[model samples]
Target: MPAFDIQTARFNMIEQQIRPWNVLDSGVLDLLASVRRDEFVPPEHKALAYADLEIPLPGGQYMLTPRVEARLLQDAAVQKTDSVLEIGTGSGFLTALLARRAARVLSLELSPELVAFAKSNLQKAGITNVDVRQGDGSQGAAAQGPFDVIVLGGSVADVPHKLLDQLKIGGRLAAIVGDDPIMRATIITRTSATDFRTSQPWDCDAPRLQNFAQVSRFTF
Candidate 1:
């Protein structure tokens, strides 16, 4: 086991990088303090676990920066009774964090390899409330319909309609919007049966998830 001061470094990073960028949720802070990020990262990359940079995974996928991950978790405003939908389960670190905050969490991963790894990570962390599934997140997890909070791990060109259909009224969805260089993280909440509102939280950069990549319709 890699031994490092997890809580102290996590607290410092949360205060220095994340809080400066407007992350002030006590719940989120607590979750970050409790969950050990180093455990989820590759043994060789464990030193970079809390750095404010993306961590490369086995696949082409990478874990979001600690700041971005913390920001998303804070913006979600997770409740103990809420059920969460996580679109990408990279290392299961964030999934475990959500498992601690939410009543239940369903995370979908496009890579079977990642899904298997995540399940092992989650098990190692002793988290039982999170369900990791292998599938296309954009198509949406219909069987686990009506999530109270839906979170996409990567930026999307637009919010998938299928995701909107799966949110219960008054539910919230947090995702990074736009493409490349300049993308803003946002939250969309269903206020009523017919009303929805969107809020931009902060600037972030996340690789597009294969599950939610926009399709090209024409070639010139």
Candidate 2:
């Protein structure tokens, strides 16, 4: 294949894919533009870095689409003073984005290989504010409690209450919820110690997160 114009492709991804999807936050747009996504993609898939599709990772997990990633980042409204917890740190692309906006980020991935991959990528990008760990993210990092933001890089049938409890009051969590074929991009804000408000602002499907609580199926 011929050499691709990476700059032009990145610009089009922000303008055509992300911006049109309602990711209008200036800081988020800037971050999206500044982050070199191609560097995080596996060599074989580097050409698809700016494409509107999930790039495959070592594990079965995938990097979220550009629009989905940008939308989640914008919706979470991460601040420089905030601490973030990110689930499913696939290629660490989103982790880098979160680190750019937050004071610190603790990212979890189920696959040990992915953990190492993400760490390497983040380190190469000079992102020091993130700690990538290999573990099941469904339980959330309670020991690191009261994070200002929690983001699930994949979809879940439901956002576990355990994870929500890990949020600081007024903190926000973003996830794609529901089964495949149709899922809602939902954001939950912890209004108080015992109250959380949720809104489904858009629809998208992502690979289901492993180890999350599943609805029991019973038959008579």
Candidate 3:
């Protein structure tokens, strides 16, 4: 078997998959180029790092597709002075990206193993500004409240109001919302203390976040 050209594959992933998905933000593009995604991927799936697929994680969760991850990063527009709250730290790839753009990032994960995996990945990358905690991300980190940006690493039936409340006025939260077969990638911005503006800029599907609100079933 011939060895794959990692640099060429990474370039193709950005130019062919991500760029065509409308991820045009320069900072995000640069980060995509620089971050060694293969390092974050589980060794068994490392070869699929730039293959436009959601590589599986240990807890039945998945790392978001490269395009979806890039789009979310672009939409969040995280800044160097901003503090970020990231929900669902699966592979911690997105956590690494968020750390690069924000002054600080607090990422919450539901599984202890995943938390340890993410911390190891981030630490190996020498990412010092991120704090990976094991907890229910749906609850939002209140003590670290009023963040400048929030991003959900998985899809939800609806963006939790509790998470929105953790955002400062003018802050933005990005998530893939709705059920499987179809979902909207939504960005909600807080315009005032009680007001938020939401828009579905694109469509994509991601695995449901654990412990989030689910639509109740009905029977006759």
Which residue ranges in model 2 land beyond 4 Å of their true spot?
A: 1-4, 217-220
lDDT of each: 0.87, 0.93, 0.93
Give lDDT tens digits, candidate 1, residues 1-220: 3355666677678888888878788778777877889889877888788888889987888998888888898888889999999999999998998889999999999999899989999999999999999989988887878999999888898898789888999899999988778799999999888788999967878988885657456978
Candidates, ranked, TM-score:
3, 2, 1
On residues 1-220, what C-alpha lDDT tens digit does candidate 2 reach at each position? Answer: 2335788889999999999999999999999888999989998998899999988888677899999999999999999999999999999999999999999999999999999899999999999999999888998999987899999999998888999999999999999999868899999999999999999999998888889987666999
Q: Against the true structure, whose lDDT is highest? A: 3
The backbone clash count of each candidate, in order, is 0, 0, 0
Q: If scored against the real structure, what TM-score would every candidate get?
A: 0.93, 0.96, 0.96
Q: Write the per-residue lDDT of candidate 3 for residues 25-53, one digit (tens) a residue.
A: 88999999999899999989888898899
Considering lDDT, which of the candidate structures 2 and 3 is the better prediction for this target? 3
